[model samples]
Target: MTEQGTVLMTYATARLSDADIEALGSELDRIRADVVASRGERDASYIHTVIKVQRGLEVGGRTLLLGSLLPPLWLAGTAMLSAAKILENMEIGHNVLHGQWDWMRDPEIHSTTWEWDLVTPAAAWKHTHNDLHHTWTNVVGRDRDIGYTIIRMSEDQAWRPWHLAQPAYNLLLAAVFEWGIALFDLELDDVVHGRKSKRELFDQVRAVLGKAIRQAAKDYVLFPLLSGPSAVPTLVANLTANVVRNVWAHTIIFCGHFPDGVEQFTVAEVDGETRGGWYLRQLLGSANIDGSRLLHVLSGNLSHQIEHHLFPDLPSNRYAEIAPQVRALCGRFALPYTTGPLYHQAASAWKRVFRMAFPSHPRPSHPRPSHPRREAAAVAPYAMA
Candidate 1:
């Protein structure tokens, strides 16, 4: 290992005995089968419940209003119960939206068609999330999610005045505008900044506009017409649910990859690296959060981020089952497995945000390019989070 906390090339090339590798592979397959079976059963019930509740609110508005001013706190608590429904939405709902669940029975369809029938248009999310952010992750030039006005992820970007003036305030801004940040990306960076081509920009613009119209129809027109004055409480319930859900979603996502130990590389660096090397860097650079089985399940097992990186095509439900094997592999190879509780990781990520927002010194030039073999050879193990 090198002084920079990167695993060395020797470690990367080290092979476990063939029997151990086969055993690990077999263990992963067994876990995948279990997850698929369990998830299939749970998700069918989950989808039915969501459909029933949404329909109940729509059809029996008066009865619902008379019985409870808002959704029963427990029902409405989908927002505040961050660990429960929000995680459920992320794990189960998201997979369903992606058509990753039972794709053989119902093949994966584009989000544009109503076949998916997501609460939100799955296409827009696929474009921003699966296509852009997941593909690029911490690459500032490409990943729209990380480049907030003041909380820039890349070290190459110049610090703004407001960023320098009030560091804590910027973080507060991030927390408050987390939902809006993605929208801003669609409008500003992706469109106005010319990051996207003209055709792609127009497509995104249409998607965003369509989503706004659908939301307005539901929140403003349909609900008010149905519930009269009682609609106020219903609106409140919906808004509260949205707030809770958004907060949970934002917090889980932000903490996963943005923590202190994660590195933000320049476009120049990323452009120069080989695909395999880049994948390895992403594995080394991202941090994972620790949580319970439900938490792991809900976050799409993204807390097992390293495994996810290593095997993106594999279902997330398989992550926890494969985690120990991956950890053992890391241990045998002396790779640092960076992980911690959610808040601890979040705090660390926030500090990095602060440093990016208010740099104490001028930014340095990009590092000179080096040979891949030499680069791999010079690597040191990352510190465990």
Candidate 2:
């Protein structure tokens, strides 16, 4: 068997009988149903409270920065701003744009209305991230998020000499992750491949530039200028905060998506996928961070990446509640529940980044498993989500 064939055969989903897969899907659906039924004031209050706290931090940070010439105030203000940006980007903006809070019927916090501090427009992010990424997850070719169309992420993806710099640029990418995501979300590669029109790309570019200008003006111009004698220090502080937020967001995201034991899929592997099969793929493809309640909140509950992938629109707060059940389900099914400390997971993900930067030699093959649904040629290799 080929290396690719071996991968398909060993995937946790491939060993399950059709009836077993159906049963797994049914149980997952039950979990979702229960969460949906229980969603109410508690969930609403959780999001509202987070939003208030984030705003207060931002306000306090900016107020302190007006006197940022004082080293102590600069340090305190910058730290608060960094924390505020992280909270907004990870907890509030991300989850809100995922429509996690839409069930509350509050237009003020609806996905359609919320704009993030990042350069990427919410609509563009929703299309690429919510529509394409969440649906496809770690499917190598279809999910542009595999490496954001830049870095080499999977052995299934062909490597280039340019990838040799991924280890270095990967660090730069982390520092400017919001910009990287904004560019990635534009789907420029799709335009090259004729999957997206140049005209569409042009319009998206305009939207990105508009958002970028506003974000730049706020953080760089308006706030700094408002500081008068402390303008330069305040400007430096704002820049530091944004970079800190970017690096932290990148770390949390990479830890969840690329860490050891997180599986990548081929389109062929997912062809004609059933509900249970989808659940299985998500479970295997996503790894979680083992952390406290604060860490969970800061990650927008994406520390529970498996549960988030399984039920993307469910309330973020409910992830912790459902996590034990999901882990138990994986245990019952004899599937891997990939979770570890943040440091370990982050290190594993970074190790993969460096490893994939080099050429990937084929692994020795194993006999193919007798999967009832392994239709390796049923779909085109580059099938879009």
Task: Report the number of the highest-lDDT candidate.
Answer: 2
Q: Any residue pairs clashing in model 1, and if so which? A: 2-380, 5-380, 5-381, 5-382, 6-380, 6-381, 7-380, 79-244
- Clash count in backbone of candidate 2: 0
Instruction: For candidate 2, give the lDDT of residue 79.
Output: 94
How accurate locally, in lDDT, is each candidate? 0.55, 0.87
Please report the candidate that would top TM-score against the real structure: 2
User: Per model, how many backbone clashes are there?
Assistant: 8, 0
lDDT of 2 by residue, 39-100 (tens): 99998999899999999999999999999999999999999999999999988988999999
Clashes, model 1: 8
- TM-score, per-candidate, Cα-based: 0.69, 0.92
- Record all residue pairs in model 2 with backbone atoms less than 3 Å apart, i.e. clashing: none
What's the lDDT of the predicted structure labeled candidate 2? 0.87
Worst 10 residues of 2 by lDDT: 1-10
